[model samples]
Target chain A: MSKGPFKLERAGLLQLLQALKTQGYLTLGPTVREGAIVYDELHRLEDLPIGYTDHQEGGSYRLEQRGDGAMFGYNVGPHSWKRFMHPPILRLFRARQANGDLEFESEGEAAPKYAFIGVRACELQAIRVQDRVFLGGPYQDPHYKARREQVFIVAVNCTQAGHTCFCASVESGPRAQTGFDLALTEVVDGEHSYFVGEVGSEAGARLLDRVAHRAAQEAEWNQALALVDRAARQMRHLDTQGLKERLYQSLEHPRWQVVANRCLSCGNCTQVCPTCFCTSVEDHTDLAGQVAERTRRWDSCFTADFSYLHGGSVRVSTLARYRQWLTHKLASWQDQFGLLGCVGCGRCITWCPVGIDLTEEVAAMNDVQTGRFAPKEAGGAHV
Target chain B: MVSLPSPIVVDPMRPRPFRVARVMRETADVVTLELEAQTGPPLRFQPGQFTMLYVFGVGEVPISISGDPQKPERLVHTIRKVGAVTEALCNLRKGAVVGVRGPFGSHWPLEQARGHDVVMVAGGIGLPPLRPAIYHLLHHRQDYGRVYLLYGARTPRDLLFPEELKRWQYTLSHAPGATPVRVTVDRAEGDWDGAVGLVTSLIAPLTIDPSRTTALMVGPEVMMRFTIAELRKRGIPEENLYLSMERNMKCAVGFCGHCQLGPHFVCRDGPVLAFPQVRDWMTRKEV
Candidate 1:
């Protein structure tokens, strides 16, 4: 009667799609294909990642299958809530010259009510970061502010760890504390599997009432808690306290040189980064060549031209630019936005050509911060 | 006779290829264009902001406000033909059309500098940005403190606003709210009786109450740097000093980081920056 938690049998849960579809719900979840885990238009429950999990680091990425058909078994991905909310590129305004007057037209808003099927804790935090970035900021981005309000989130507890994940280190993860419409913990037994789904919103409670599910018993809740606890214990973690300040002080640290030697400057890390939102503007005239239209494109900090000015670029060297980017994401981000830029996702390390792990980088910096490593003379150190 | 006050509801101005309204070849490289904002609201800009002047295939460049802010009807851009867009803009004839986006970037602190004695120091073609300030000073002389101008051009002919400068000196002198003028040329030809040497050299002769004065400066960053250094030696506070900067600005909005200087966007946060606000970034090349 408390509406505390409910249980759905594993086989019955796979039919969760048919139930949602009949109820006019759009189920969006992860589908693995082409060696990468991507979000796509999913219709059937079969499209979900049942026995798949992924390994991600700075620049290295891999997707693999598990022994079981356990659904919802992956970490944060290249796509985040930003895509549905902000949309990578949106037309802001158009100028029309009419009757010798310029008119600034506000673009039409996107219309979609989304259901994020496999949301994780780190992503929940990432959503809040973007919320603060797009809405909480003084500008109040109209597009992001609107789309975020229409979504219903289904948070899944991570019972498996990814190589690049360290939300446990940053006090962000392993469990969904808040910011979800529904939270689920998948518990598998030898031949019998069930899910403990807790309704976090009235919208979720109303939706669940339509499905056939048993009220979770006290024992079932405890088992769900145990499953979540095990996942937390398995987390590959990182410590985030004062990490910003420590990184800021290490601008010339040899770690940058080591990272640059391996960095291809391919810009994969930022492309997959949930928090990187810088953009560039472009102007194009129609095929008729009568009118010109200006559009904005997503931009990355790794590009040297990104910082170019009248005289020259501020960051002239590759080493300095790389240091600026890494330090900004880990250190200066807090100074600019009052939050840690990293979400503990290991896409940077995993996708990196040379396996330049952020964990190792931070560990080296931590050691250097505490005087554990001998400072090298100029041009004397790299990795 | 008096003029009616200008409309301020301000429609979003549109860019039209004004058949080069009339190009006055000011100097070797600098030329001024008079364009009418087509079917768009009249263009309005402050002393220090800029407009993106676009030539068909040539590209766009940020040119400063070289017209009177009070006269928001017609748009005036004084450009130095240094790059592709500048060359294209210069090549346009009395009727060549082009696109324009702006009156963008933060304007000079005209209202803020109203009651304070204003010292204007400009170098090379940097004088365009200060053109609006000079116009404002001449228009509302009573509202401001004593006005002064220090101008320096690369050569005798490179100087701009020639006709206006002559009147601003002769016709506008002894008129209410007028400022003293000090013009200089780095290298002069015949009939150049103005002060010689750097623009900074002329500052020594002008007496300014640093405490009550605001220095409006525009020019090459180096010229502004040396002039500001000399002013600082005069014990001028950084708060009262200002500089209008330029970069290859593609988008005037804050979205594009092209015109960014450290934490601030030159288009939005400034084309005008107080010395103290940009002191750190100015140490690097971008600023």
Candidate 2:
């Protein structure tokens, strides 16, 4: 419970996990599952992906054994903290017909108190973005607020950068700047692999007191700092200055059509994105017209029905859907939420079936505007 | 720091139970349901604002408040049988319970259009949504300049409130500085004596002063587009013209993204918006 950074060894990681469990938290952390590191319920330290590191780029992700026994080395995966906070689907309420009269009841399941472990800096930013969407607005989502209120974040500072990572460029990652109860910097140097625990809240400081840890040595802090710097250097760059206005101006940009040709409109990019929060609600009824349930499920803009109107679908073409997604992410999001929708976690880039790198696409648009990219000469199409 | 007008603690998604007081058949496919809230004070809403009408064990759909805004006790909704929920709602009998959430979205700026030459245009089922506005204007007859209502339907059979329209025409004829109500049909079938052409054609006979005139239109997108074009040809400022837009809405609040039109959430920002606000987006083939 000291006022400074503490050093927790590889063995001490177990005590931290045990403490979260003892505190009645539904602890969740990264685990190797289905050939990818995904967030799941954590019961033991063995659930952590020890000695595993992930290699990620556009349309690719591979987990490699580092042999260094680093517990948190992966950058990110398809799964995000939204899977816990916003949820893919939630029942808003239940309506039942009783005595020929209908009664509406908010019988949704009680929100679970989650202690999210191994949350990355970019993911922390993503959580903040979702908070704005679901909780910050005037009409707060009661369901999202109930789940988000009791969350205790265990944020991890990145020591390695995935090929698709651009969090450093977005000024959102490489280190947990804020929005975490407890922050950790995993340092794997030479024979030692440990974490520098920085308590961000009184609750985190109290929890640290129960863990087997000592004050972080000057050498250990320096290593953690060096690790973050290395990751930042390795991260890709994205020029986001004036991106909002630039995207708004490029509504008729030809590059949109080119990208549309490659985009499957499969909506995988939206599904994997940590910040995409659009959802659709449906009413389901049991046979004999007895009970009705209103359910809201995650919906993607890529789908034609997302913007369907009485006459027809508003965004009938893939071009319009792609335009809506990218424009909202980089441009109109600022207008809607006062923040860019993207957190540069690279999930969309890594999971795209056609390897459509958003960072590259953005850069290409800028290049076309700046006369650096010749659309006709490069792809046999005119700009 | 743009926030919603009010932060309601009660779940806006949940609807208050309402019972169908009376159901009047407007047309073969359309029914006008008089809904009375089962409990609590009556639901108050502005003209052109809509409510998410939920049929138990069926679904929910956004139907405009077609009744008088002044009378909040009993809500009147004119619903056409289009989809599953609407079909179920159309079949609902008196005493049937329905879930009502809203009146959500921006209302017709009737207050702003006061003292201006008001021209209201509606096509077919679009007439019901504009009925409330017409009622408001009629109630405050001295508050505006010349008022004209141009209504068009597919056929005479499709026309809504024929007796009501005749009554209004009679009342306006007897009133001082009386308003004019015009009726038209796309194709006049058997004994129909109304003008036969597009609804936009009705705009030509009316003396609309572009500088001080305000037009409110509601209908299919194609009809609205042509109406806007006719309004524009008449030299109406885009800001003075308003249109009520319809999109597939799940949650009548901003939370459900189904009602989004470009950057605007039709449920929140508007089901009614000024022509200028949607000018560029309206012409774009697919938004």
lDDT of 2 by residue, A241-348 (tens): 999877766777789899999999999999999999888887888887688898999999999888875656888899999988998898877877888899988989
Model 2 chain A: ten consecutive residues of lowest lDDT: A374-383
Q: Pick the candidate with the highest DockQ.
A: 2
lDDT of 2 by residue, B204-247 (tens): 77765678899999988778888877887888787988999988
Of the true interface contacts, what fraction does each candidate have?
Answer: 0.08, 0.48
lDDT of 1 by residue, A255-277 (tens): 77787787777677777677766
- Per-model TM-score (chain A alone): 0.89, 0.94
